[model samples]
Target: MDRKHRGACLCNRVQFEVEGNFDSFFLCYCEHCRKDTGSAHAANLFSRSATLNWLKGRESVRTYRLDKTQHSKSFCLNCGSALPTHDEHLNLLVVPSGSLDTAVDIKPDARIFLGSKAEWVDKLDCIPGFDTLPQLER
Candidate 1:
């Protein structure tokens, strides 16, 4: 049986279901990915055979394709959360890992575009971590 995953936008305005297992997971640190996610890297699951179905609030989803490039992203217009996008040219479905409400069983297969990674990325492991928001000096 094919694995199924459900997800929603930050505001829960949009919901979707992905059917089939992800063929690969990747942490992309390219400049374009960083700009798209506003983060150090983008965790994405890629599958060529999987299907994406919007279960609710489909109208709230908008896709942006970068002109003169294969880069593209789909997001919720309401909450500005990343959503899955299908690349017709590549025949692949790219899903942002964080958008999935369901737990992901697979780990990232690789980290790509290390040359474009943020300067602070290498020292991230040395930073203090907090379970929740910890008290900080102002």
Candidate 2:
């Protein structure tokens, strides 16, 4: 049976469903990825055969492609949350892992572009973890 995954934007302005299994999951530390996510890395799932269907708010979706680069991102114009982008040139579908409302069955295959990884990313395991926001000290 084929797998299906549903997702929505932060504001719930955009909703979609991907109707195929992901080919690979990658944590990318490239400079463009870092800037796109505003974090240490970008967790994205890639699929060559998957089809993206916009369930709702299709008009609210917008895509931005960097000039002179293959880098592109699709997002909800209302909340600026990352959404799935289908690259016609590559014939690939790229989905942001966090945007999915359903559970992901696949683990990340690899971390790419490690040379551009943030300095603080390496020490993340050594830092304190919290279940929720910790109270500020008086």
Candidate 3:
């Protein structure tokens, strides 16, 4: 039997599920990925066998395809949170790791496009850690 993983947008308006194990997991640092995620990188799970099922708010899911590249992203219309998108040409389903509400059995296999990563990314681990937001002096 295949395992099912559930996911939702930040607003909880868009809910979805993926069946079976993800075949590939990657942390992409390409410029397009950074722009799409609005972050240094995108953690994505790719699966050729898993099936995607949208449980709710299917109408609220929207996708934007980059004009000149294969890069694209699906997001919730309400909160702009990333969602899953199927690449028809590649026959792969791409799911944003951050959007998952259920635990993932797979782990990132590699980090790609390191050349396009932000310079600050290399120094992030050196920064101070916090359990919660630090109070600022008034």
Candidate 4:
């Protein structure tokens, strides 16, 4: 039996699903990943056997590729949320972990591009953790 994972964009305009197990997971700290996610790193799940099916709003998804590099990302045009994109060259499907609405059984396999990580990223554990958004000191 194939496992199904559901996902959607922030606006809920774009909905999708992936069937089959994820093969690998990675937290990428490369420059393109940081810029693509607007964060220190991008958490992505990869699979060569899984199949992606669009439930709705497939037209809302757009892909961007860097001019001189193979770095690319797919995002919802409405809410700008990350989505999965298939790499033809690698024959792999890469999905942003945060984009999924369902619980994931696979954990990250490794953190890549450590050399490109931000200096402050190493201090993440030292910072106070919050269950939810904390009150801002205005």
Candidate 5:
């Protein structure tokens, strides 16, 4: 099978290929993500298990597990680039959408944790906003 999405760190010190179309994509304005990305929102992509594998720089990959101890955010230790996100409950992996080598047709369809969005962030007119992750489709 052909792999679909390939990506690397800003310095190209690390690289990975993610397979399959994104199952779900959303923007997170939640404080944790905002602090991690140093951006107002973090673009996220959900991929199936076995769809992600590091092709290089595995030594530079690191895991940041929130003290809450549930989910661990995967990123490049050297460049601080986001990789895949692991949610304990959902058992789904979220890839940092920006890491894609090229843009995918999947646009972020939702905004989450808007209640905690930064004061400077302007309101978007039409996208659905949720205080938390939406109910997963079975």
Candidate 6:
């Protein structure tokens, strides 16, 4: 049997499903994430972009494109809650952890765009922190 993930917006107007263990858990301090989530940092659970299929209320999903970067974000239109962000280049779909309907014991594996992190924000247990996206030698 395979594990499945489920979640929805505050009003339960929009719901979705994602298959498989979270690819990675990371805190994003990018401006797009900050403004979209209205928080210091966004708790991001990365998975395949295609896996996050809306189970219902597709029209309630709103998108915000900040700046010229193609990495725009989607959220619940009614609640203004952050949904998932898709990174086309990485083939990654980053789901806002708070939206998950089930409990998650996963912690952020890393931090990205630390330079852009809010001044008042403090380190949360000091995970593998990075000022920018971690570049792996591929």
Clashes of each: 0, 0, 0, 0, 0, 0
Tell me the tens digit of each residue's lDDT in model 5 across 75-110: 888878888655657767788888889677767889
Writing each residue's lDDT as its tens digit, candidate 6 over 32-100 gives 778767888888888773377789878999877766675677888888777766676778887888888
lDDT string, candidate 3, 66-134, tens digits: 888888899999999999999898888999999999988878999999999999999999899899998
Q: In model 3, what is the error at residue 83, expressed in angstroms?
A: 0.3
TM-score of 1: 0.97
- Name the better of 2 and 4 by TM-score: 2
RMSD of every prediction: 0.8, 0.8, 1.1, 1.0, 10.4, 10.6
Evaluate all candidate structures by whole-model CA lDDT and list the values in order: 0.96, 0.96, 0.94, 0.93, 0.80, 0.79
Q: What is the model-wide C-alpha lDDT for candidate 6?
A: 0.79
Count backbone clashes in candidate 6.
0
TM-score for all models, in order of appearance? 0.97, 0.97, 0.95, 0.96, 0.79, 0.76
- List candidate 2 stretches off by more than 4 Å: none
Candidate 5 vs candidate 6: the TM-score winner is 5
Model 3: lDDT to the true structure = 0.94
How do the residues 1-73 of candidate 4 rate in per-residue lDDT, one tens digit apiece?
6689999999999999999989899999998999889999999999999999999999999999888787889
Q: What is the C-alpha lDDT profile of model 2 across 1-138, one tens digit per residue?
A: 569999999999899999999999999999999999999999999999989999999999999999999999999999999999999999999999999999989999999999999988989999999999999999
Which residue runs does candidate 4 get wrong by more than 4 Å?
A: none
